[model samples]
Target: MSTFRLAARVLGLAALVALLAACATGPRITTEADPEADFSRYRSFAFYSPLAIESRGYSSASSERMKAAARAEMEARGYVFTTEKPDLWLNINAYTQQRTDVTSMPTVDYAYYYSYRARGYYVVPYWRDRTDVHRYTEGTLNVDLIDASRNRLVWEGIAVGRVGRSGDAAERGARIDGAMADIFAQYPYRAGMVPAPR
Candidate 1:
């Protein structure tokens, strides 16, 4: 890969790690649900047979952790986990992309001048404008709830944040769990009950 692309990938990986590891103060989360769809009618949940995050006919480790996280959240909400027919089916997706940030600011620059009278060098300071370009990775996690019978989306949660470059599988899994919890906390409905106004 090109140097730029490689740097972006590294930054992206870092951002993904940060996105999962730093939940309370890092990721920004948003959620939306189908206004017309009744949440109370849903009592059971299942993951899509082939999750959106899957590739080459297999599931990724991150996808498996995401599934486990979602299952916990759903079950806590009184939704049963089932592979068979379910009232709701969830599609989970995670991805990272390179982002560029450009900033400009006024900076102080220094220069030295030779002074014959003083027989020494004098320091002169001036104001200079500078611009900096920064490259980093942005990670996103999306959870979509679909009506199995109608095969239509009913609710969705999205999280976006800078991913840091650190963590092992266990740590990543914990972070994924944190991210999932943050997403589900936005879910306003319980099984067989309408969402209360927030």
Candidate 2:
């Protein structure tokens, strides 16, 4: 009933409208090499390094962290990590650049306008507020893994999700760790134990 109470209600409604329109997209997938590469034979193979990266239109601190995380990931999966020309030479290279993506949103504007009620009282429909439209820029990160001894490419993975140019080191590390954990879930390298399909 008070002026302050009416203002508060209008603000809450406006906030809710804005958030409902912003939705995140599903993860993206990119593969330069064969994703279906068989890995039934690579039980005891070594990772050259997992965080090797290839980028397009974006910055790449993500790649470096990816490499480190990949190494940790491979190690976690019971695979050996080596740098001295072991059974498998893991060679990972990464690059990144900025890219432009388009987004669409409705525009919403609120103003104090007057309407008359049957009782001759001034009423503001609380400003239904036109839908607001906006555009926001988001970042994408790509990653891949390869086995050198076989001389054939092995596994690859990619994702397009919310990210930051510069962020908390630990948070970035965690992000890399999480992204890689998903990508390597299918670890396509099988060393010499798994044979290719006939």
lDDT by residue for model 1 (40-88), tens: 8999988887888884579778888898899999999999888889999
- Candidate 1 regions exceeding 4 Å error are 1-25, 114-123
**Against the true structure, what is each candidate's TM-score?**
0.79, 0.52
Residue 13 lDDT, candidate 1, scale 0-100:
78
Report the C-alpha lDDT of model 2 over 1-198, residue by residue, as the tens digit. 975576677667756865774553334545565556545544444544333344343436655676677667666766666555545444445334455555443333334544555545453443333443434444455544455666666655665555555567887677667766766664544334454455
> In order, how many clashes per candidate?
8, 27
Q: List the candidate 2 regions with Cα displacement exceeding 4 Å.
A: 1-36, 44-64, 84-140, 186-198
RMSD of each: 9.9, 7.1
Q: What would the TM-score be for candidate 1 when compared with the true structure? A: 0.79
Pick by TM-score: which candidate is best? Answer: 1
